[model samples]
Target: MLPMEEKFIYTDEEKERSEQILTELQDTLGQSFLENDLPKLRNHLSRSIAANAIRRNVFGLNPILCALQTAAIAVKDIGLKRDSVLAILLHQSVQDGNLTLEEIDSRFGEGVSKIIHGLIRIRMLYQKTPVIESENFRNLLLSFAEDMRVILIMIADRVNLMRQIRDVENKEAQRSVSEEASYLYAPLAHKLGLYQLKSELEDLSLKYLEHDAYYLIKDKLNATKAARDAYISSFITPVSEHLKAAGLKFHIKGRTKSIHSIWQKMKKQKCGFEGIYDLFAIRIILDSPADKEKMQCWQAYSIVTDMYQPNPKRLRDWLSVPKSNGYECLHITVLGPDKKWVEVQIRTERMDEIAEHGLAAHWRYKGVKAEGGMDDWLASIRAALEAGDNLEVMDQFKSDLYEKEIYVFTPKGDLLKFPKGVTVLDFAYHIHSKIGNQCVGGKINGKNVSFRTELHSGDTVEILTSTTQKPKQEWLNICKSSRAKAKIRLALKETQVKDGLYAKELLERRFKNKKIDIEEATMGHLLRKMGFKEVSEFYKQIAEEKLDPNYIIEEYQKVYNHDHNLNQPKEAESAENFEFENPSTEFLKKNDDVLVIDQNLKGLDFSLAKCCHPIYGDPVFGFVTVSGGIKIHRCDCPNAPEMRKRFGYRIVKARWSGKGTSQYAITLRVIGNDDIGIVSNISNIISKDEKIVMRSINIDSHDGLFSGNLVVLLDDNSKLNMLIKKLRTVKGVKEVVRI
Candidate 1:
């Protein structure tokens, strides 16, 4: 700890305020904690402030002061443990303060330092946007799972920052902060079961995001507070008396809903402020022992129903099996005076704390138990992070975080929760990857169903598996879960590896039989010439029969013959030495860049004929046109025979002596059945090939049939053929041909 003179220069009033906050924090942590390390902790706090002041100008209150206040709030308000509180106080220092990680570790223990490190890394990850933002957010959740304390501190820190956001002067900064709080942090808080923090964050964010609407809702809520309180008093009076008569010790309070929630209700229901119902809720806090908690909750439910007619569908019983986030309560909407619906929540004091403080309260009161506790929730998050790092995994993480969950049961009566719209295959993968890979079908509720059948709440599903069953490439399009897709990809890659090895062995045997003695270096050059990036890719293409073995042998022979001729004597060559069947083809000239006509057509310009769009490797001849310029045409051009008969003397021999290094514009015609996502699927395949550039695509569909035209820029004919082969594999595509 630093000396007293080096401490933060706080005014007398600020010092008093800090002391008061520290005292409250110590009191909440209890006297036993104060006796052990409170003094040392307090010294560390002062030294942190001093270190921060030296490196940066202390703001009006300074982040250190704000952090301490937030830590105190976490303890007294959120019921977090000592480790979490310490993490909150020091989290900012890890990134912004003069203190380093080693210094923090020396001051505090390793556990606190580790949590701080994780928090800093998560914050850094959050700074990335758009491309990898979702991936980073999923990583943030995984970090939270590694240590629940990190998220607890983050929630506390966000709550404090939101409360103080009004002091920020920049409007754009305020908007950015408010949007992040509303879209990311508030939903996270709600998912963690911290209703109080969630509501506060939402309300604060709304105040900044929609200034006019927030003020209107705020004014209306304030105006109706008096009348609403009277109505609540009159409504609960009879129920209170009945509970008293039944000898049930409980506390009933009128809880006014937050302004943001009321506004959300108005918008969602398409109603005005006056038309909104359930603006306030009544919470019944019962005092019951641990053994009688569930029984007492149901008993209270029965009593409430006796006093008023309850809407059966509006009832939710979480006491029997608390929510995955450790929320336990019984909620019911009862018809009250003037046919108004009054929402009532019944829970014990312990349940109330957990509901308000969320995971922090769970850790504080229940400890870290493995079953249906915080540990279990953490394990699920960890499993999701371990699944894979891809767009599919990010989608799964977001679905798990934000989507409504449905609870189902197994044949053994064990309850399981999955995101809504999950299918039987997702369930199988959730059980085990091997089970999912080998799953042939499933029986939902004792009736056979397809693997794509969507699961619903309370459905018991049993996956049928076969030993010979294997995952198909089409399964990637059917499964919705990230784990299933990842496992399938891994299995397919392994199979490809094995097939590639066998193809390589076959190729080597063929080479040995031919006495070619093809070495690895020679093979590398051959594969590169064929536009293959890897030897395995070349072998895989061979094994898939996409490349013909005869073509490979011919190409290898060409290379061998070229090398053999290079060792022999050189031969004189000239354009006039070439022989042709027709005497008129005698004066042909060769050009490295473009075709050159004979001296007879010397002054004539030459251009490729568009009729055939002849490329470098095609057999070609030149024609003297009416404009007196030589025009090149492929031997197979549709007009070649007519031109040959019409003007035989005008034809001139032409050949390309060097390779063309330019992209050629080409058009392809695709016909297929109209299907969803087919265009996007085709686009994905095209964009994935680095050598292929798609210039434009047009599609027309009618009566279940679709025809598409694609204009692309490509290097050579081989790439065009490879692209056509890939496009044929897209679902619903029937035929692909180049026009």
Candidate 2:
């Protein structure tokens, strides 16, 4: 977030300042004995000071100074931990390749490494690119999921740069960083309760953006500084004396309003800076015990109101009831010495810290805290990503989520969103059931983990699959979302049905081979003996190999023998109820004199449909015509749809039962080069096959290509296909298709 270009050179004074910062940091975070012990806090500090000007960021800001200022804010203002501070200090080192994340992980801890990694990634996102797409901005928001501390630290870094940019010379980087601070960092600070820092960021932004207006406001404030100081001093004397009389330990200060606030007031009131009253407020932060915080604040309010007339409409007693964001103060606007309206705020030390520190203060002073912001932060980011491009969207992003959600990425960087508690299996199913069924586990952020690992907000997931892996009943327990559960159920059901079919086929084949005919009721009894209430379950066990097919067959033989006398033969079952190797073979079963599947037909006049000429060996069906004659058509014939729907009552089961004695015409549209003797080659090929005869050859030639409908008489479809294949092999024959 560096703004404007600056020289790489560091002044001697700046080096001393960095060393002083290092000293200050060590006191904040406890000291380390040596260079290699426990984050090596002092050791890293020494290196950072040495490496100050040696490394500069994209905006050419010195890394050492930026880190020092950012870490100072993080520790003093936000109450962050050593890990966060370490990340702030080491982010630039990691970015410049002078340090590795693994080294940080080993030296400090994983927490520090993760924070630095997030900062490094954010830096890389904008390092080479000036134009930030909406997607990248979205990634920036979601990156907080890696570590919300990153967000806090970046705001600190931006503030440091904004303060220094006035001396830098670059115009474009300055404007860019200024606009970001205005729209992005400023609002974020306000949300986090870093009000003082928030004002600083925006006022600096105003300086960069509205240069003339900023200086004008500054000049006015400067001209009245003496009088303003005298007034503030006069206001404080009475409050201080009253608090001291009450035996209260407190300090009071008057703050001049930020330039941005004054500018906004000027715009709203339609007046210049002089006309904008209430330019500053006085804050009375008390050092009160936890139990007496509220009482002491109310007492201070009473003292203030006694000295000056309080405005009833302007009094805000937040101490009675804190805001949802946990702001507690007693604010009063009173008529002061010169009939000027002055705002005064009273709060305890704890309350002030909570107010100044933003998210961390409430979380820390309240109780044990989570490193990541709760679901509200996630919900807000999701809403902003979905909402139109407005910084206010991110500003107000902290809304509670109706349904908790997590966003993940595919190996290819395709983003996917899922509800909270969704697992790796859920993500796989979200992609496809095929992947889900085959998924064994996955690699999250390149670390191999189980399929049951729950996803977080910013996870990069690459699903791992095995060809042999399949959905199991236990998978239902692992599933979170109903969609994944439903998919797993469906896959399991399909596999069961398939297994049942295989078992049924195997049983039928066994029964046929052994010449055993059993009733459906008898098979039901066998299934019950196998501990299955349903016949489908029996077959499932068989397919799963829990119940061997051979064992089931043996049990069947014993049951058959027990039910009937072995000496007497039983009547064979009807072929219609039989299970053949396959349907096509049963229908096309051949015999000595003819193909021998009985159609159970008497003498009926049958003719092939002229629309789709049916040949022998083709799967054909019989449709009785309106005139009582039968029309034999291929199962996939064009006219079959009309025939079946319009005249379904007249249809009958049919198949070829004998060799075709009658020849039928089949046309082949052949396209090829207009080569001499090509026509003779086609005709000769058809004549050489004694079973097929060329009935007609009609060729049309245009521009070296000859196309013709060659009609031939053939009794079998297989023979026709063979002739087509043979003609294709002929030179100059480019295309041949059945018409």
Candidate 3:
């Protein structure tokens, strides 16, 4: 007899059940499953379930094993390889079980284990990080550095969850997952070239995010289904026959616009769903080789457009320059037989496969990453991570991978894609991180603007950079892309740290000039004496010229009442010795003897120009020959040249002596619907005293509408927070906008 079989852990029934799943897969996949793939799938499930069983002892849930089986079945139907199928089977093993890397490798081979490891990395997002949701997502994208397959499987898992979210008992959990599916996964799927998955995820998300709205749209779509189908059929049938007659073998199918899509168009266009033109679409799948696909598709497009009156403006040639996601299709909107607009897409079978599978199939079949041209995309992310703090890394990681992209071009005629609202800083960094770190200014579409200039589509950005000009902490406010923000933040931190060290040395040198030896300890003590907790705090005050080093020496001298015998030389005279001063008498005399006219000057009733912001130290020039006699402006103001040209003889140079003058208030009319705290906040910003002084304050609100105007007195026009930053912070202030 054969040697007695060793004792087995699994019972016969369990073995048979596992075998049954394998048989079902074989029956479904047929010869496509292959012998190697069949053994791999069976063995993968067996080892994975065994590992999950250990986890079940503690957590008491083994749904991961079932999920694996389901995913294997799903993927098998797609004719995926053993590696991808095995990845599906063992994806969650490490997440749920105590399986080590060696255990996985021993059972599933290195390739399979690596994919599983990627899955494990993705799973860690849910557990390892402090942030549970978005941060987890952020970590997931960042961790794709080691292996990207984990992300693909993770997306697949998300798609599966979206499909079966109703099975979840917790409504809140269902909603959360649904929203995540919609917000994160759907867009990611689209980005990865998984068009079908993207569409499904979006449809499922819409179902939950706005159930009532989704259902209403679904009902309307269903009502028009017959008519829409008939129209699509009539439209495609002729085209399909013509293509066939031309010896082109192509498959044609009709598509209805998704509810979410229809709703979006309606919302964006501000019209009813009925107003949507391309509610029905026709997708043509051509049986052409990969190399000839684009040419053939264009030919097909020409033929179809010839038959139907093509809307020239509506044609989208994605085949020429595919989306960042590698989605390649020829799209056109044409007037159909019924005189209504219809959309059409033409692509090859291979293109359709890649579009549906996205990055998953790219690796699953080709054994490489997706070619949506994200090689550099991911490299930038990894670089950002390696060079940045966790927050910066997370920000770059999210924006690069998940943010909405806008395609812009360079002067060299190269296409550069950026996130929506990305600024010139983002473009600079995208070109070279150093350029971004040192970007001072740029020209967008040939007009000089700040680094913070918001980029628009088709604008050619020329980054003006200087190694001497480092990023400022203030750049955090305007740079929208994560990469630029992270680089700016890193540069700012480094600069601040360097400045801190330099400030310490400068302070010590200054203290030495005062005959005081300043050590770190002495500086700390001095800061505490000044109610500051740290020496850097004191240094910052000195650097900003808020705290004078000379004053510190005096304070120290007063506190001790005697000098220490240590013969240390003090630093040179501090900045305070050179006080802020006005123009000298000689300089003032040179400017046409401009003086406060004691006699009513013949043509000079001076009023400051609202736009030019002329302060006391500014080089002022007066323009006479205006309604407001002498319109004082900064000499470099844009309007100065125009005024000087029109009335050159009337222009007069003006200067302010170092004297405090009574403040002159400027009136700013704010026109926004009145709301809570708006008036109070505006008054607070404009008034020094709690009491608001107004020449006239008007208020009007009718039928729940509200708007108002406040006229208040201030010391000078310089203190007018009425329009810029302060007014922007007020609630319901639609426009703090200068009038």
Candidate 4:
């Protein structure tokens, strides 16, 4: 359930959109590619779109276009390679089950597959959760520290998503996506020195979260355009003239601050829009040699400082020691015309590109050198991350106070890295494919432990394997790394294929023993009649023992006699048996229905969504599902906003009908002090109400607080409220909420 996936509505629209993106991809190539590579590139794009043919992402946008746009940013704005672009494009195809990593490796290369592997490794972090857990976030940082390109591609992808979400009707999704953008993507962009993208992400996030505040600042800035432009011209003209006269090759440009930054300033300073001064900054990008870049920047800084009074505290010089991401700049705030403050940034073209494109541009510069390449930087990061067992000792990464990963040493003293919460089974798989297939258990730090035993960093690990032991389906959940999971999947698939061959041999023997003539037509009819689409599936079922050998032989005999005149099987359309009559004013008026689901969707039936049960007299909306049924979800349902944003065309306004006469099951979460008999007290209140059926109650006490889920059957929202009020009156019951 990453956004823009699932619930595929139309195939033709996807094809049309894919064709458009393919053109854009060709355009993106232009003259930067070899003529001989065009056919291969076309073949790759064709295969990619074919795999992701029916999928959409980012509020009902084509996922292929989503990737194409991100690749465009990575190439045009971030200066990434074709490999990075291919990773971004084909990663979704692999994730959506349409393609495989092995296929990518065979068709493209191991390099592209590696980057896609990194992308999928950390794909779970983008779920629609209120807050990312501390441990998960740290693991994410570890993943980012492993591959800086993943961070850049993800930032680019998020930027593409933020720009497209404005037309989405789901405000809740917008707010959540906007908030995550503000919290994670913006900071990562800033840290990577993608200042322009960082500011744009911040502004878009503000537009989604605080609509009024964003527009208010935007309006103020718009209203003061004349005066602001005059002042900027006055400041830049003088600076430009002085720089030119001083024999410096440079150009100066001034612009207003981002609306988000201005709004933030207004809040932090506790002032109105006009109260914030220094609302803009002027950038001086110098065209200088790679060697004279610093000297020229200082010379330009001197010319500006001499004209305006420089504030000592506002001076920042990073020319001597560039940021880790290779951002080099000199910043200063000075008193300008009319005693107003103005911020100034001075850097060379190379420095500016590094600041604009972040690590990718830095990589471009360092690609010419021999030492401290991207691989070396990542190796150093991995070493630092794995160097500590106690994160408290590491003074840096306060937000990630404790690195939630563990590093263990092999018996030969070789070091390996693993995220925290992984077990010895994962370690075995990381060692070798054969070892994982035969892994039984392991001894950690000279202490024998089960395959499920969690290992800590700095501990020596020894893996135990038996040739007879084989992988089981349950082992899939035991391993955490993508490589281990993929190996297990491959091993299981190989076993299944072997088992299928064995089953086929058994079937042929049975047919020969029964003296029955075997024909391909007979097998096809028998397979279809037995509810299997593929002949391999029929054999696979027999291997798994879901299909009986005797049953298959009997069915084949029956099909051979009757299936000759039968046409090939065609899928049946499921027509729902129900009615949605016009809403009565009596039922409708009681709810004050703004959303009246008056018409029955042509052939689809509707049901209340179980995630958020829509009780009688509750506000609701209809969502068309892939199952050809409409799910009625509460207006306030957590997933409602996402549904609206993604499939707005399929959304139907709904209201509860008064004709309903049913007791809906709702789960209520009750929290209070862990007093004696608190659970008993709550249960008694539910039991006392003869109208309300007390379904079940599960209680847990933690840190002197009582928290429990109380499942109860109620008639409607009114009764739900009454029961909640009664529960609140109980001793030690502090809060009650329907979930």
Candidate 5:
């Protein structure tokens, strides 16, 4: 650790700020905080904070330091120790290099060091693979990490950064940071139950990503707040009065959903703001507890639905189990007096607390004694850590974090949450570590489930684990849960290590049988030839069946092949036989980098240009570009038949296997009489298909006629044709044409 003499001393202004923070920190720590520890705590916190800035090359630590100090103060209020506070202050410092691990270990306890290390690991572990970035993948992996505070701290840090990102000098840098803060950090904050922080991050992020949209929404919201309040008050009057007359006790509050959320809903549903169904949601915070809450909410749901006609499909009952994020509420979408759809959420005070505080707050309120089965999840993570290597555990962590989870139940009504599309192997692992290891099969709701069977919500899963059954290495590829994958890998690695020793012994025995004494020199040469510098690497490969012992014998035998029956070498005889000498080794070496335009390339069929949707998985032919590359076009591609007729010689046979995941943008032109809800009708038809994603819409209406073009993502021509047919079925008496 840096000594007091070497540590940075705060300026007068900074000292004052630090002192103010110290006061609050002491309050939070209370009797646990030692007065004598103040100087050392200051040094650690300062070094960590300073190190983070310097390492990220974010120089001149005026505001950032102030922000860090403020954040430290805020986190201390949560009752963290001096080390935890210091770590929080300097969380990013290691990556920045303001302080080293040695300093951290010496200054802070191992627990603090571990937390810092976990943070570092999370940063490094994520995004190492290209596939982990998918939002679904990320959420799946996070669920298994079992460290809520790590994620929470990171989120807090991001939130703090976003609040002060504009103070960053560089324009490009500011935009980049803002975009990330909006896209990732904001949504994460919302999901984590940090409502205030989530909204701020989201609004700030939107300010950068869609400044015009953000301001437009903000302006409209500000202008309408009073009017909106009046409308809500008018709407709620009858419900409140009726409930009072009915002698039912309830509380009502008005809420407008976040602007960002509204914007996303509009974009997703392909509708304008006016068309959104549930902009304003009425939340009823009930005065009840655990058992009575769900029953009371259901009774209330019945009462509300009786008074207001509800969209049966729109009713969501999460009060019974709550979301994985700890959000619990009963939501109902009902037609109000004016026939407009309005959403209502009902929840108890305890549920509301969990919704806001999530797992951490729950732990604070009830400790581990709260019998919710979350302990099993925590145990799974600890088990995964103990049984797996760093990389293996990291993979499991990511899978759990990013996956959409399914909440199932056992026969006895115990709740079980599995990652969406989880297999029986995951269920086995969830039951117990050993069961997962020895799981051979499973029965879901008394039906024999295949090993690859995807589990659904409400399934009662029973694992069939055998003592003889072991984790298959192939399971690593198929397992969805990080815990299962990690444990499997750990088991495989241990088995491999054991097998490697056996292979080493076997190799030594073979050498002895052949009278070939394996010395360090011989082993080194063999190892180097195989691209391994260590004997252990060779043994491991041998154990893995990657290297053949017979190959070694052949290599040794080849040495004598050069000096065959003649006194001269074999090369002398070859030279005598051949009048023409072979070229030098350098001349014989092929330059593979040279792009070869083969005569067979003409017959090699079409090469799809991914830039334009060539649809290689459809009937295709080549269009030779002037830039010297063949561009494949689908037979029905607007340009294809024309290109084929013009350049017949370039066109080659292409066939479709009919499998594709990539989306192709297809333009559809619709002509119809102008009418209200024409766009809505068209959108309903397009969206109902489920397979199509509308990329953009251009509507042109003039002289009582409506004509527009929609750019939609489709899988193939069939889907495009189907969409066109569907659009024609709309009641405007319009013609749908593909453009």
Candidate 6:
């Protein structure tokens, strides 16, 4: 027996509206789409829209209906593919309806499911928390790394949202939305080559964020609309006639500047609307083949400039080298009717399509197999994501995203693009992480420059490297790219890990000499006795030679003795019980104020010379003195020459045999502008480097300038140089010279 099958039924109105929408989609997508995929797509969309009709009041509109409309716009208006349209339609399915990714995969395909998954992730990021807007935007870009179609859907969705923002009633919500759209979404659209969408987003955002100013400009524009149109007609009539006589197929159209753009100009120039020149642009779109676009565009530029005097500085030739986002157009400003400045844009029909629809049109006009223009951009986004999450990383990511790009050349004549204000160190890292780590400096156009040199366009750069050079922590402040900073941090962490392991081994060997087993408990006890919070901290101190291993061994020995003889009577130790025998009378007379050396070198005593104040890690020698047993002097000290001349044989070869725990004083002189925060800023910079300790500071401010001397305690020359480099990066610091 056959079971009766149930069929889903649609109401008369639902069927009529669904047919209408499908017909519209057919008209926009052409007959091939209707014959191929429209029936199944229509069935799914109809059910999805019906299910979502109950919760369609977020902005007092049906979200599913709006989504379908947006998808159709993406397909017909923006020339997107069938998968893109389907993804757009179901982007919110999981969040809004009973549909799941599994069901979508079964109905549509894996491609649609993947795009929908990316879109859902982005939506979840938005809905989670209002943390850092820049971080959220960065994550959004990172999401695009998985599927670029996600960004296209997001742009289309934003366009639809901006179109319907006027229906929302809450002023505060509207303002918030507008500000985000202006600052974040508009910039993204611009970066993606969606010129029309960017303009609309910017204009709508300005209308909501600055309502009063927007209306004032809008009213003024309306008041001058008739006059501006007449002027445009008069200005273009002569150019139109010339192009016609030249047998060129072209259509010239007038474009009014967006309100946001005009507002920005007014604020920058501090002028009223009337003072703003070139309020509109005339676009001349030529009908030419893809191969002839560049030639025809330039030919049209010649015709337009022949009618008016062109501003030399205002001429932009983008036809030769398109923008990074794939926008191709030639622009020029000229003195037009009534001596007013008028801007003109010349491009072929293919170029016009790209400018209008952005990458969407690029894919369609260039065919599906053509190279995707966003691979490099996606790579950068993925790099940032792999760098990890933090406020500093977010700031670097934003800087890379929004800053203007500059083009430079390698020694091999290959062109490379980097963000403006990028230093040579950043360029090195862009080539490879290893190269950046070992970079000493570089040569720009055959002249040597520091690694901190800001690169400019068209400069030939050659990175100089040395096998011994390594990345210093201070390089983080010098390199502008996020990738460089991330790599530097990783390298430093790996080095520290290795050093920590070596320190642990050294401590273990010392413990073994005392006949004590080195275990976790023993290590913990030692860390507490040494005032360290963790074993790793104790190990790091040992590795840096900041803490003496002998001191650690003595502490553990005391514990060992106490545990073995808790009940024994305490006995006062006499001077005779000391390990070192009393120095001979001759030794006492020779050593007046010299401190006692370690037990291993019991017969010797020495004091660091005041002339050099030699610290740990310095190349030093011991000098036998009449009153002092031995005086330690740096190898390059000023007194070394005089001493050698006076008593050459008195000098004996000496090196630091044990850890030096005492601090050594060093002086630094700084000169800079006498700003209010100059002193505090310098202090802050010095404080941030953990290895250096400030002893004292003396400053004199006069005539809007300041000179200061700082006495700081440092272990070695490396720490001193690092501190000096950090001080030089301060805002008012002009010079940081070692005194």
RMSD of each candidate? 23.3, 23.9, 26.0, 35.0, 33.3, 21.6
lDDT head-to-head 1 vs 5, winner: 1
TM-score of 6: 0.45
* lDDT values, one for every candidate: 0.68, 0.72, 0.61, 0.71, 0.60, 0.68
Residue 144 local lDDT, model 1 = 31
**Candidate 6 lDDT over residue span 1-739, tens digit each:** 1122322334576456646765686676564342546667657666754543334444655555677667765665445665667777666656566678898788777767877887876665454343324423433354332565576577778777777778587667677777777766776655555657778898898887788889999999899889988998999899989999988899999877888889998998899987676687898999988777777787888877888889998888878877666768888998888888888989888788665454533323322222223434533433333342221122222213323555566776555667679999999999998899899999997899999999975567889999988788899999887888998898778877888999988988887777778556555654543335556656776787766677667656655555556445756654222211111224223333323333335347576676565666677888888985788888888889999999998888776655444555666778999876667667656645667755556577789998767767666777877788888998988999754
2 or 6, which is superior by lDDT? 2
Whichever of 1 and 4 has more lDDT, that candidate is 4
Backbone clash total, candidate 1: 0
Q: What clash pairs does model 4 have? A: 4-56, 4-57
lDDT of 2: 0.72
List, residue by residue over 1-739, the lDDT tens digit for candidate 1.
3454655566787678777887787777764252546666667667765554423122234565677778875665456656666777666666766568887677666766777887885665444231222222332354333455566567777788777767666678778778777766775565455667878999999999998989998998788779878889988898889888888889998877888988888899999877665776999999988888898888889999988899898888888877776779898998877677889999998888665454534333322222223333533433332342221122222213323455455665455666668888888888988898888889997899998998865567889998888777898888776777888888788878888988988888887787778755666656544545567767876787655566687667655665557435557543222111111111122322455466433435677676565655667899989888778988988899999998999999886654555565556778998877677677657656767765556567899998867766665667877898999999999999765
lDDT of 4 by residue, 305-392 (tens): 9999998987878788876656688989989999888999899988886554445343334321212223333323333423422211
Q: What is candidate 5's CA lDDT for residue 21?
A: 73
TM-score quality measure for candidate 2: 0.44
Clashing pairs in 2: none
Looking at model 6, report the run of 10 residues with the lowest lDDT sum. Answer: 575-584
TM-score-best of 2 and 4: 2
lDDT of 3 at 314: 81
Compute the lDDT for candidate 3: 0.61
User: Which residue runs of candidate 1 sit more than 4 Å off their true CA positions?
Assistant: 1-13, 26-61, 81-83, 130-139, 142-145, 243-253, 283-335, 338-340, 345-375, 378-739
lDDT of 3 by residue, 1-739 (tens): 1123422245576456656765675665465444566565556556644543423212222344345455553454222344555667665556555456787687657866766776664554334222223322333353343554445455677776776565555667778778777756765555444557767788888887788878888999889788877888888889988898877879988888778788888888888776787877889999998778888998899889889999888888878887655767888988998788888889899887655554323322322234333544554433332243221122233324433445555655455656678888889888987888878899876789987788754466788988788777678888787877787778777776787787767767877776775554554444434445445555655565555567677556543442344434656653222111111223222333232422334334566666554545456877765464667777788787887788788777676644453433233446665565555555445433422233333446666555554444343334555335676677766665322
The digit string of per-residue lDDT tens for model 5 on 1-739 reads 3344454545688667667776776776666544555677566556554653322324234543544554563363222344455556555666567667677777665545655765775665343332332343234324422344455456667666666555567657767767666655655544433556667777877776687888877888888899777767876787777666755567898778888878878888998777778877898777765567778778777777888899888888777776565667898998876676789988777776554444533332222122243333443433332243221122233323333566454544455656677888887777777888888888887888766678865466777878988777788777899987887888877777777899988887877888876655556544443334455656765675655576565444433332244234445433122212221223212211111123323233234443234432355555667666656556677766666678777655544543535556555668998776677667656645667765445567799898766766666777777788888887883788654
| Alpha-carbon shift of residue 633 in model 4 (angstroms) | 98
Q: Candidate 6: how large is its RMSD?
A: 21.6
TM for candidate 3 is 0.42
